[model samples]
Target: MTEKNPSQKTVSSRQNIRKWLLIISFLLIPVTIFYISPIVAMMGAGKGIVTSAILLYILLFVVSLVVARLWCGWLCPMGAWQEICSPIFKHTVADGWRNWIKYGVTVLLFAMLAFTFISAGGIHAVDPFFGTVNGISITSFQILMIVVIIFLIIFAAAFFTGRRGFCHVLCPIAGLMVAGRKIRNLIGWPALQLDTAAGHCIDCKKCSNECPMGLDVNGMVRQGDMENADCILCASCADACPKGAITYGWKKK
Candidate 1:
């Protein structure tokens, strides 16, 4: 086997760091569940909706307006889980009209939240650790079951559909991020984005193949349209490209 070059080693080290960071974040999900749980956010302590998840999502959306879904790429436990299972199903999910499903789900979830709040006469209290037991997620058998079922569905979706299938088709949080990204784009704000130099591309499809989100990175590079709402900003394409055709940069201009 040929010895790896220094640049390859550097890229490999960065990829490993990103992977381990995601794994560590995913491992801490049980503790951070209270802050990210949709159920707990939607249904409060038998009174009104919990404010933690809502506040967390709001913060995420604000971040997305500037960074464009970095939360999904770097910190989301569900994204980490799907990536861990990518070896089992490395197929690219077909992106078409089907991608609209997540938006519909987001709308439905918002509608439900609104109805719940209205029924309860608006949010009455704020409990960051609403469903959690002493700030831990899996305290009781019931909570454990709920967590198990959620993971089961996530796993099933990734196993059958493709890489980050649930994120593409089902995650309401993704829809929210997309909305934030769209608003940023419309306003032409300086935001985190993938910058590509199509002239440097050597037709190597490694970037596209290595993309965890299964985006057509090669095509995007060729078209000089590197900004996609679906892009999670993982920078896998940048690392995988040998020619340094792709890069992560802010769209400041």
Candidate 2:
């Protein structure tokens, strides 16, 4: 009977809390749908109105320009849903075709949205409740069906591809944030990102194993190149590292 290594066994309180937070966010989708709905964004664009979801997308882009993809790790209900389904398969998603999917989606969706907005005359009004049912989502059977199918797609993505598959493969929001992060990197601005002290690493590999995004945190540390656009700055690696080799902060990277 061999004991499990602490590095292999430990799931830190920080990560547990983050998982719970994301789960809670998922549960709150009914109340939050209008604020994050991609469909609403398109509808709003066509109406020449700025919807909550449209504003949210803009905010997400701006925030990512400052802090990378914190929204993906912190408050995205879709991300939370993926986290819930990831454990069912418990594997890394294929990094080939799937990884490029979001980029294409982002470009196509944004182009269509921009076209609609421009054709519709652009920014005529602002409506936080653009497509909501008296300020709440899921107000009808038809709406419920659409919502269910969206969630089902999210579920299928994670179950089949494993570990935040929708995020890597199909999230337009993720594509937006990735673009923002790239811009930030190019600008060399002070922003929120992971910092590493390679000298402090002892090659435990716990950081790599603990990442919910399936990132190579250990490799990033060893290479001293921690500025990955995919990194959500969730700090799971920071919490998992016993030697405090990895941390997150606001600085030029």
lDDT of 1: 0.83
Q: Where is model 2 more than 4 Å wrong at Cα?
A: 1-13
lDDT per residue as tens, model 1, 1-253: 3222236667777788889988998899778776887787777733675668888888888988888888888888989998888888778888796678889988888788888888888778887777777888777777778887998899888777788888888888888999998899889879889898898888769889998988899999999999887899988888888878887778763
Every candidate's CA RMSD: 2.4, 3.3
Compute the lDDT of residue 72 as modeled in candidate 2: 86
User: In every candidate, how many clashes are there?
Assistant: 0, 0
Model 2 error, position 77 (Å): 0.3
**Weakest lDDT window of 10 consecutive positions for candidate 2:** 1-10
Those runs of model 1 whose alpha carbons end farther than 4 Å from true positions after fitting are 1-11
